[model samples]
Target: MRRIPLFVLGVAAVAAAAVLIAPGDDEYPANVVLPSATGLIPGSKVLVNGFDAGQVDEVSIKDGRAQVTMRLTNDFAPLHAGASARIVWKAVLGERQLDVRDGPETNPVIPAGGTLDGKASDPVEMDKVLAALDPATRTHLSSLVQGLDHTVVGNETDLRQTLRQAGPAMEALGGVLRAVGSDGPAIRELVGQLNSMVTTLVNRDQQVRAIVSGLSGATEAVVQQRDQLRAALAKLPGTLGTADRMLADVPGTVDKAVPLLEDLRPATDRLPAVARTLRPVLADLRPTVAQLRPTLGALGTLLQFTPGLLDSAHGALPGTESAVTSLTPALSFLRPYTPEVVGWLSNWGSSAANYDSNGHYMRVNIPAGISSFDNNPGVMPPGMVSDPFPAPGAIAGQPWTDAFGSGVR
Candidate 1:
């Protein structure tokens, strides 16, 4: 009796377990037919507007199409016509779900026991993408992959070193990019100018081609002369260093020159007026200068003789001084009688007017003897010693009495 009871208990436990694990036979309100079920199964969740509505009940291939029968609960009932159903991956290469997008909200729900045909849009296969590449591109891609594999195979340490070294450079590059981005308008303007320049170059394409060809030739020539170039490059550092040292003193020189520049400013300011005034003077002088060409030509000869003339003048300068000194005493002795001599000449001028057709002659008479007043001269003309004596030539061999008879009377 206890064995029978144990058997019955075992049967009851089995029945309960079977009822829990069995598939449900609940009737679905609507269904949809799909073109393909490449990644879907019967137990896949059916989604309406991205929410799980129900589960797929059966999946079978009929007439080259996948007839996916969905068992939607009452909440997902009345699946409207014109609704679209597709099996979408929940995650990349992950489990698929049935997505149903209903048509217009006003569209009538699909009738029960009716089929809704849906289009399945599958993800592109990797093979198809690979097959689409051209031969050259494929070759390049293959080479790139092989090179990467080779680089990674045994160069892990080197790769790590390279990445470490690149960190600072990448940081610096980021900083530069950030700085450039901060000046957005300036960068845009630069880009615009570059675009204009490119357009100009494009417009002059033939010229650009010629320039490129010339540059190519020049590059070849430079390559041929690389040894000389290298020698020059070797010397360039020292040259640059010397130049830098020389330039170091320039600021001091410039500071020293500041005062001079400040002083020159006033002069420079007046230069325009000076230049204006000089213009007419220079124009007028042009002809005079032209006329002076001969004179100027002789100037060189004049200059050549000037030394000799100067030497002669220097030699005679002492003699001239001596002669001038000697004349001083004679000039002093004659100084008192100068007035008498002047008076005699004034009185005798009226008396000495006689002339003949044969020749000119002076009319004059000589007194025979000295008068008492001759010791002291008077300013009057008739006084003794006032009149000048007759010239010796006029009195020669002639008696004074006869010559001066009229004057003595």
Candidate 2:
């Protein structure tokens, strides 16, 4: 009876040891906080990189967040510091799972029962996507679907033909994709350059907007002048034809000019010498040219009044012409007497030239006539009358005489 009791006690100890060392003990517990626990529940499957590696042991809401406790198997236990988890759809029937991803190897491994620093991503639900759309968008989406349905309804044969033709096109597109994939580094560089360009454009967005506005205005102007442009275009063909005809004569013109060009060769050869000779002359003219600047400015100022001066001259021209016409006849009539006037002026100057100390005086002589009071009858000459007061017939019959015997009849 004592041996049986000892054996039973040993067996109990071994069973306890086995239970302590079981595979379940290798599992590590961890906690992850999520924004919501909508699809998660206790006993939900946990996947690590798409492989089942653990299970959600409990899910509780605390501080407005879903605190999920997970028991991971040994293979995925002690996840690194950067490890993350997300609740994802597992099936079409609203089934959900926790998807855990391993962190980079550079990160420190997380201890068992520790909370993961990374938060769980919220589950993406189709119903939520549908609910997010506004009424107009939903209506448009429905219309698009109906349109597609209508388009496909009666186009089976055409669709088949299109599909058949698309095979080669798809193959070509695949080849192009493969080519692009092979040149990924170059494509990446191009993409980087494009990104840099886009960034520069974004930095100068105001200038870009101004340019776009200017282009829009220019486009509008062009549109407004489209009729004029069209007319110009209509005339262009004839213009081009005329130009072509003109150009056709060019070779003959060139041929004809060849001899002239050859004839000018000697002169052309001398041009360098002429240029060299003129170099110093041009240099000498520089100061003169500089001096002329003020003069030229004055000339320009004077030139500004030229039009007004010309107008004034034009206004005076008619009066001058009329005066010249009036004076012409008088001048012509006096022309023949010019010599007599000149002689008289000369004689008068000579006559007035005689002078003495008492100044110039003219001598006068009076001879006795028939009417003189001192006249005697015995001294009377032939045909003379002695009466002081003679009859008119007697006065008429006698001729008057001066002391010089010059008779005045």
Candidate 3:
């Protein structure tokens, strides 16, 4: 103010130059070819992953396609190859925007002015949707709306109550859904098993039908005897009481049998070995048992007459005893002469055995003094010098019968 400083003026000049030369923002241009550009226009917002990062600079029709130019800030610029775009509703008021998506980082970045083929997903207009419906469909939709309006218009209170109650119902349904989801695999397996069971039942339909028919016949038979069945049923309580009383003792009996079973444990343990041993023995005995059949038959035949034989023997026993008693003395008397009788018989056989062309003849030696004709006197035959028959002790100096004592012999 007093006198403008040159240094301040120079400083202001540098600040002005810096503001004019400094870069504002880095923007990349991109083109999108869309099938339609219904709500898209210049100044429409562009979004990348739901974040505003650019705006549509222009929209024009070219070769039957809507060619849109986008100006994107550097933060979202130079989208990689394979980038895509789609026009979507920004709000319920028919406002539209372009939704962009970046491709994989591994792809090269798209250069400025590169084109992307936008997905033809124009915002849906309710009027167009209604207009596209066929007459029949529209009629059905009108009928449904009328039915709903009739159901709900006058019953607003009840509908509100139902809606309020529906909260718990929906919560319960959600819990059920969660539970079902948790056991999905198990439920699926159960369903598969049920399917298999159904298949099996189908396969065995004839047998199952036969069984059902038999059961039906049995049921009819039972029904025919309903009177008797009723009588039995009338007695059933008493019978059941008796059975209950009887069965009450069963536990006691079982308790008593436990020790017996325990006592028999050792024998039971050895039973397998016993059975193994008996197997071969029983096999070997089978032939022997077969052989004994005839003998047993003969014995059976013999036994049939055994009582008569026993009776006859019983009657003859007394007489046989008496005869044996009668023979006892004679047998005793002959017992002492047994050796002499045996010797005489042997000597007589030898003497009578002589044979010479004729029949057998006895050889005898006649003593000189033993002529049978003269019994009056002691006679000597011719050529006899001495007595051929000596006195009892003359020839042997011993008595002739000294061996025979004064005893019973």
Best by lDDT: 3
The candidate scoring highest on TM-score is 1
| Per-candidate TM-score against the hidden true structure | 0.32, 0.31, 0.31
Residue 314 C-alpha lDDT in model 3 = 97
Candidates ranked by TM-score: 1, 3, 2
Q: Which candidate do you rate higher for lDDT, 1 or 3?
A: 3
Evaluation by TM-score, superior candidate among 1 and 3? 1
* Cα lDDT computed for each candidate against the true fold: 0.76, 0.80, 0.83
* Residue 200 of model 3, lDDT score: 100
Cα lDDT of candidate 3 equals: 0.83
* Candidate 1 clash pair list: none
How well does model 1 score by local distance difference test?
Answer: 0.76
How many clashes (backbone N, Cα, C below 3 Å) per candidate? 0, 0, 0
Q: Which ten-residue region of model 3 has the weakest summed lDDT? A: 399-408
